[model samples]
Target: MKYIFATFLLLNTFHLFGQESAPINHELSFQFDNDLLFFDAGDRYYTNGLFFTYRQKIKEDRSWSNLFGFQSLHKSIFHVAFVSKIFNPYNLKGEKAEEIDRPYAGELYVDGLYTSYWGQNRLAVGVDLGWLGTKTRSDDIQTNLHTTFGWVRPRGWRDYQIHDTPIAHLYTGLSREIVSIGPLSLISDVDVRVGTINTNAAAAITMRLGRSQPLDASVLTHARTGERIANDRKCKELFFVTKTQLMHVFYDATIEGNIIGEPSPFVKSAEPWVWMQSVGVMLSMKTFDLQALWSFLGREVVGGRPHKYGTLVIAKRF
Candidate 1:
């Protein structure tokens, strides 16, 4: 319901920035991303996604985080993360001068945080050992983006989830500390994917709207059922986004959906529902976040076919 007034004012505004009265401090940072105008639904692509995050708090509860990621396409990273799914089961073919190593999708996490005696908000429990090369990687950005629905990919990059079976996974997450206005801060998180889709679910709502207020908004939603595409089981998505950080630097727009039954080839059982839209902009730099997007699909309720487009993403996160 419109995120219930920004998730109840971001849970009482995280009790005022999850305060600790200022004292325990330690910092580390690293981020790099470059999609350079990429699109998956229509399959017009370009990707260079590299994410590395490491954080250690060791005292205020406990924390350990490590995530090293890589993806490459006309700019290869094993043909953009190598895929087939469930994890992987040998499916790598090469071309364009060879060196196609088959599998690797990094992920490692250890966590424990409960800082709310008035620290504001904190409650976490984690564990996720990973590998699932791309083919949508089940569509990331935290898997739940609502505008209509989710899951879209036409060819190479939609590889059954890294090639169908390579397991060693575990996940659990719950984070809440919603509400911070005036530089804008609102966060909500939920994750439970455990041992690979028994009842997968993910949710996130974040609004940090302020770098001098150009405008920022985020919404992600996800649900699961086997991973679809053969009888088209079940999948859900909604990613309504709004970004404009101080006159450009990065601008965005999104609305996507896909639901099916009568053997969806892109939904046309008389059309269950398929919608897409993307806008663009990126030119300054808070940390260089570029942008570009144009996508297609509509068949009743909004109509369709305008060029069947694609292109969006140009990243740099320092």
Candidate 2:
């Protein structure tokens, strides 16, 4: 952990500096997450994730755009992504399914998002469609990953895995800048979700320092990226960011199993509220954008402990 943090500092220090807001015509990104990146962090709940996204500035005339708040924007981007998430019990050494601390679950889905920018605010809404349980193929993916990396293979997935079921969910969030001074800014956000997979509401605040841009024209906010028109020339960004969010979780199917279907062999009641923290750095140069962040999540299960994970993202704009 110290080494990683040191390396991040060195990279940021190397610039001591660096450097957003014509909308990129199109953008593509790949992001992945794993707890192993955080040294000494255990392999447990919310263990790994994989995502691929493609985004484009909204250009076509759509009748419902106004109905969905897409037409009220100074600018808007529409994106679609394929995402997968893997979860495991706290202890993989359990001899029996009943001995595990949390349920073993996997989620595979595709989601589409519509985000709009206006003044100091951004609004986003999206829907997810996919499957839960063994159908997500997470056990095989994890087993192969562990074997290839020479790590401990998971135990008893067949015995304790969540049952397969279809998933549908809708979510929306709004973000606004609370304060900004040169290279520093504070932002607030509120988000809500309701669906078969998860039902929750959350609030978060993010602080960033270093090279900065207007909230509507910032890469950190994911409002703009790639070759954006900044001073009518090339644009660059390098910043350190930290965020904290609290969620009121009403239902989590991954841990509680499909509420509308047959129950899994082992399921635990989800905690009512959860906390999450993210600390990282983002750098965007010309056509490429890169980010590295670590996420700490409060326990989702009643008796479970918190967990930490790392995420890496690479994006391209055209």
Candidate 3:
């Protein structure tokens, strides 16, 4: 498994390293992808996931656009991040106790934006909504877990390895370009979400290195605090990208990752914090765009044996 993951990363890195100069603009785009991963058996299984995305602008202010996407994770095994020993069996029913497989589920969402309404200063808002294809098992497992972690858990919910449950979300956030100091341009992506039968807020900033082949870096912070519709927690995300164009050859590479709070029953015990990371490169020629991405997701650490996952994704847009 380790070798396979290493090889996938190397292959994707080489593929993306070759394509560094690509320009993004106003146009309608559609993308579809399938991703697969294998975990140890007797306690684990593999996942076959699929995704589809569409994005376009309502008009051409070069400032307004919208995105709609769907993602499905089928035949996948979820990890158990926490352990509960003192909870009531009735309360623990249908909770995150061990790893389990879900056949398939769909996620649908849409986001819209309106930038620079008046002049130099700009603003944008976004929203997302979707449902997991299945629902939790209504049994003793759920009740038992809930009783044990009712206080320590971020949300008043137990960690559960759930399947076929609905997953829906909504987000509204804004951003502004505050400074342009020489070769550096600073921008922000901030938003608030009210869904999951709760509410949460998140924000991130981007600092562009104008002279360095249009490279840019960013950091994001998200939290769920108070009783206003979200939970109470905090996390950080980092991102960086660079692109170079030499006549007909163009290449670009981007890396992004996040340290997020894990509230799900599956990962309740391993640690309240988890990490998700991805790196990608794209090469373009005229109207053709070719790209490859390597991603790592799941708990940041697991006892003496850390659990890590990786994927190689290829995509094209025109």
Model 2 alpha-carbon miss at residue 8, Å: 20
> 74-154, model 3: which lDDT tens digit per residue?
111111111111111112122333322211112233433332222222233444443331222222333343357552221
Q: What is candidate 2's lDDT per residue for 1-318, written digit by digit as tens?
A: 355444434443332113344445777777779887787446788888888888877664755434455434566777899998999988877758567878888999999998878778888889999999987788898888788887778886888888888889998999999999988999999999999879999999999899877766677767564234444234477899999999999999888878766778777889999999999998876555789999999988988898889998877666
Candidate whose TM-score is highest? 2
- lDDT score, residue 3, model 2? 52
**TM-score between model 3 and native:** 0.38
What TM value does model 2 have? 0.87
lDDT agreement of model 2 with the native: 0.80
How well does model 1 score by local distance difference test?
Answer: 0.27
Residues forming the 10-long window of minimal summed lDDT in candidate 3: 249-258
